[model samples]
Target chain A: MATTETVAGAAGEASQKGMPQLNFATWPNQIFWLVVALVIIYIVLTKIAMPRIAAVLAERKGTIGNDLAAAEELKSKAKAAEKAYNAALEQARADATKIIAATKAAIQKDLDVAMAAADVQISAKAAESEKRIAEIRAGAVAAVSEVARDTAGALVEALGGHADASAIEAAVSERLKG
Target chain B: MTVADQGLVIDPMHQFQIVPLFGGDTLTWYTPTNQTLWLGIAVAVISLLMIVGSSSKAVIPGRTQSISELLYTFIHNMVEEVTGHEGAKFFPYLMVLFTFIVTSNLLGLIPGAFAPTSHIAVTAVLALMVFLTVTLVGFYNKGIGFLGMFWVSSAPLALRPILALIEIISYFVRPLSHSIRLGGNIMAGHAVMKVFAGFAGVMGIASIVPIAAIAAIYGLELLVAVVQAYVFTILTCVYLRDAVGEAHH
Candidate 1:
């Protein structure tokens, strides 16, 4: 420690100008140079740096704002497009429903017409068959009566009596009536 | 009376010496000295950061550009915070002061480089400039009402005159404290480093301790350099509030 102090003291004495900072001789030179340095710095900054940086910052803010606005616009456009699509889809679905209902009604109408025609044709055929059956029954009855009359005549003739067709017919009718 | 004779080589104050750069016995005001060289270096560094670094004008700044921008925003905010919106006009001046001080302080940390900020003459000029500018701005903005800063209206009328006297003295002392604080901090750190380095030279194997201290103190000094610049600028802003801002006192 003593050696350190002595050396520092000795070095200080050798320099002979105690605390060179307080020395007034160099103050002018330092102040002049300091002024020059500051002026140069000031000019460089004001002229070149500040404006450029400020412009860049302002431009960035503008770009960000513009991009945000653009994004918002696009989003609204997409929403509008989606809404249009939905509306179209709804319209198509309603049209489809209407078409199906109309087709069903038309088909039902055609089916009703065809069924009525078929029913008329079936009823007409049934009525005509019934009339033909009645007619055949009447003819069968006449044939039977004719057979009986002939048989009665043969029997009378075989018994060696007069063969009377009118009387036989009248008696057979009376027996058939009973 | 030499370090060789004293068996220790510590000349802590020698670093503050303003010697001529060219071979000369006399130093004129315009004569370029080591002080001039370092000041020029400080200016170049400032230009590089402010001009070349930002030449890209990139919206998304590159590394150097970001650094310059960061410094810009930092100082800008400081001015705005202290001086309010009206003080924005002084932003360029404060930026110059900040960049110059911080650059020179950092440069001074180089083993043999002279730090202009370590000199009272340099810091006094800076503080005086701030003082004068603040005075000019105060008068310009408020006219005669600028003197209202010294008047303590909040105090009782009987005590106001005394308080005014105190305010006036403190206001004048601002430049002194402002310049000394920066110069003193820088000068002390550099001198301490030199003292430790001188110990390292004489301590043989034990010199590792002083060498280690120098390393540690170097880091502290780096912080000091930046902090002092900040302090100087912030104080400037605070003083500026009297000029540009409404007299809230």
Candidate 2:
């Protein structure tokens, strides 16, 4: 209650003194200070602060733009590298195919040459065996004729009949011919 | 006055008083006052924040530099959005108004500080300047066709005159409403806090209520401080759009 009374008293005093803000006399002073302050602030902001901030912003923008451009350049470079890698991969495949084909042809030629040499040796061995067979057959025929002649003489002596060697040979030869 | 008497006196309005800084028998136009000192302080602080803070112009901004840059972009985008590309020409003006008003409002939140924006003289002058500039630009750019802003071509021909009259009256009332809106809001917030503070003295142990109320109001005033500055600047841009905007026809 005592606090309220003091508050009222203070309010009364303030009212009695008149609100300085409402007082027309001080309006010009306040207005003058306001204008001066605003003008000064305006000049400072426009001339100094704003320009500095703008420069910073522009610098940041410029840096960002340059970064983007650099990124674009790098992206293109990477793409080119990828394309080259693909081209190299294709070339490697093509080269491998050529090497495989060349190896196959060389092996085929060597196989053909080896097969021809083996055929010639087999034919030569067959021809030599045929000649030896012919020689053996001729020797067998002579031995057979001599044995017939000896057999005929022994038969004639045992029988006490005369037998001629030339006649015996002629008879055996004629039989052989027939 | 005795100490008891002084302690009991709850003069909440006393904070708003403009006493001269130097002892003077007569208050003159040139007399330095608390308003001057605080205004100077605001200017100095803004200079420190903007000029000194951004002196390095670092690509990576420091604390003060970041604040300055943020404030610059915020107002820059606002002006661009509100008034289109041409509004950039008035960007510095809007920036100045926003920083001054917001800084002044925030500074005024300090105990025993004066809010320049709370004064009718200050807000009125600022509003008047906006009104005058918008008007002059409208006239200069659009010539007599500026008057067509009041005429609603879309309205029925029979009601066109009435609509135009209303528009004219509302247009003229722009400065009045603009000034009162800012000044009244700031003044009312401060006055309410003062009343709450007065109650604090009388409420004794229950002074907690009044103290809490003051705290809440202070928080609200902080929001109001920034919002009022934004409101004032955006409104300026809206009015400027009328001046430099492209014609529909």
How much of the true A–B contact set does each candidate keep? 0.70, 0.54
Instruction: Considering the two chains of model 2, state its CAPRI-style docking category.
Output: acceptable
Best by lDDT: 1
Chain B alone, TM-score of each model? 0.96, 0.94
DockQ of 1: 0.32
- Which digits, one per residue and each the tens of the lDDT, describe model 1 over residues A147-174? 8888888889999999877899998898
DockQ for every model comes to 0.32, 0.26
* Runs of candidate 1 exceeding 4 Å displacement: A1-18, A121-178, B1-6, B204-208
* Candidate 2 runs further than 4 Å off: A1-18, A118-178, B1-9, B247-249
Query: For model 2, which pairs clash?
Result: none
Model 2 agreement with the true structure over B1-249: per-residue lDDT tens digits: 112553565555567766677745344666677888898999988988889767999988899999999999999999999998987898988998899999999999998888888888888999999999999989998999998888888889999999989988999999999999998888889988987888787768999999999999999999999999999999999999988897442
User: Per-residue error at B210 for model 2, in Å?
Assistant: 2.3
Clashes of each: 0, 0
Using TM-score as the measure, the top candidate is: 1
